[model samples]
Target: MRNNGAVHGAFRSAAMRFFSPRALAAPYVVWMAAFVVAPIVFVVIYAFTAGDGAFTVGNFAEMGRFVGVFARSFWLALISTAVCLALGYPAAYILARESGRVQRAAVVLIMLPMWMNFLLRTYAWMSILERNGLLNRLLGALGIAPLDIIYTPAAVVIGMVYNFLPFMVLPIYSVIAKIDRSLIEAAADLGAAPRAVFTRVIAPLSLPGVLSGVTMVFVPAVSTFVISKLLGGGKEILLGDLIEMQFRGAAYNPRLGSAISLVMMVIVIVFMYFMNRFGEGEEGVAIL
Candidate 1:
């Protein structure tokens, strides 16, 4: 009887597969419909409707003034992504080449700050870079004049790089760690120098990770309003601030906000498409 009961239980468990995927996915689909899809639908509806109960194109037609702000946001994000790549590539390489224990420790250290609040980290930079802050005091001890580092476009970039550097490092390290050492050895056997091996082998192999890191840093950096608000101090206006103003500030136009948000989304999608294309090219070269 006990043996029969055990068999019955196993059969029931095996038969539960149908419920598992559907049961687990149903709530997520409902949640997405309620949150993500609903909000986007609302935005689209708002973008097309006018305040006077008419469907009009005026909201989108007035997008010309916001174009310069979007351009500034793109370039600023590009600069921040470049800075993250410059710093993260060598760091990732070192982490990937290290021993197992060292690699684990380094990864932990790199990811440790993510557990902290992002706002706290940004404010910490404020403490270091502000006038009469720790940095200036250190410079004072050296008999050097205090430098103005905060409340400028440079400060905004610094904050962005600090916030997004780990995003760049982890993906690159993941790709670098998976790289086969035999490829490097093969390049050397073929009379390729270290530089040649790195350019032809390591760089090509790591393209997917590089593309991921660039997108991670660039997209958020361009659309972030908080960093600019805290660091740029109203002197610099990015697309995020402009969209935010349409919703929350004196403008108070949800339709315009929706239009701006849609445009920004389109820009991000286009940028990612190009990055993916570049990644595919590198993959093709590596295959050959």
Candidate 2:
């Protein structure tokens, strides 16, 4: 009986080794360490030290020179995020209230354009928004004056809104779609008006998704260079553009680039922190 028990214990140990959670996670862990963790470590090293490999804080100090770029980046990203929230919330609400077939069709339509490369999409906007481009010509045919919108800050915002709108919609829609119909009905039974129900119940419940959508929109918007580059006509420089210039352009300083990147990371973290704080009071948000 003792020998049988010993054999059974050994067999169970072998099975556990093969089927444990850690064994399933091993591939993802290795991939993350090699790609994500390693790159972050290198960026930190490059950001803090000088050419001689001596520790220095000058890299961060150097970012102080481009205060305008940082400010502009934040401002544009904030505006773009606001626009996406305003547009996306209504669209998502409508879609979520629709039949399942309609919801799937709408989501697929929104996601189809994203299948193309980002550069190609931005370039396509350039063709449409250019001075003598399709948009201007159409306006001219309608007896309206051609507006010089391309290569402007407005152009940058338009690019951001067009590109990142889906990010906001998908999250909010997912949240709204899963909201218990019973809750909405209960609010109605309690003599709650449509506006009051939405404000007190629907809006508060969807706050998590709103925060997530904001983070998704704002982070990338704040760090974008490609949209500013093609749309701003290489004149309007945002934080990302400055960082890229440091590493790749005439300014060619990888240390400065890394420092700017680190600063940008901190800024994004702070923004998300505030967003999370705002949503923390919600005791009734469901992930589904």
Candidate 3:
């Protein structure tokens, strides 16, 4: 009887521990299972099945026709990520070296546009880039020719850089800001040149942030349909546009959409894995 009682007590204690408020992730796990996991499972099922629920590989085989679209998407996304990194890195480096007041003001200015509705911001850009828009009007006032920019790949890249630049800057700035001042001082004391101090110490220590920013920028830029539709004017049909068309546009092929999404998801996961491994290697080097 005592052994039975002890067993029951132990089981109850275990259950209580699992159910306790300290186990705060329990609800999150349940939510993820119902929403994220279940949706992914459905996507996988749809990707493999046909209209009549017959399994087929034709969906993937058909992807060969969209090679140009995939290439264009990756190219444009790469361009945007590169632009963001180029512009953001300098801004973040400068911002990190500024006074607290200047940093706060600069950060607010950088984030101001993000507070507006995304569509509204895009629309504003549309107007600004239009032939008779503010930018062209200013050029006209200066007796310069109006440049055609709207509905072009350049416009799409501009929109992407404007929207996602903050993502890159913030991560890099956060990492750079938290760097130990003592390490920098020590490097300088050891007669290291300014450039050498930056290259050997600050740059290496801040690589994880750069990787994070790249991931954040590249993933969304690669998969974005709206920027392509609104700015690219649907002339440059990208992978994102193709996937969206399958589900929402006249194509109405959910199976193909799911296949594209699944492929993109796997590619992104592999990319992230390499990025994380690279980050780990850099961290080890820094530690050494």
The lDDT of each candidate is 0.88, 0.90, 0.88
Report RMSD (Å) for each prediction in the order shown: 4.3, 2.6, 3.8
Better of 2 and 3 by lDDT: 2
lDDT of 3: 0.88
Residue-level lDDT of model 3, residues 1-288, one tens digit each, is 999999999999999998888787878999999999999998899999988999998788888898888888889889999999999988898899999999999889988988998888888888899889999999999999999998899999998998889889988887888789999999999999999999989998889778988988999999988887887788988888899999896899999999988988998899888888888865532210
Q: Give the TM-score of candidate 2.
A: 0.92
Report the number of the highest-lDDT candidate: 2
lDDT of 1 by residue, 92-143 (tens): 9989999999999999999898889999988988899899899999999999
For model 3, the stretches where C-alpha displacement exceeds 4 angstroms are: 1-19, 282-288
- When summed lDDT is taken over every stretch of 10 residues in candidate 1, the lowest stretch is 279-288
lDDT of 2 by residue, 21-43 (tens): 88999999999999999988888
lDDT of 2: 0.90
Best by TM-score: 2
lDDT of 3 at 281: 66
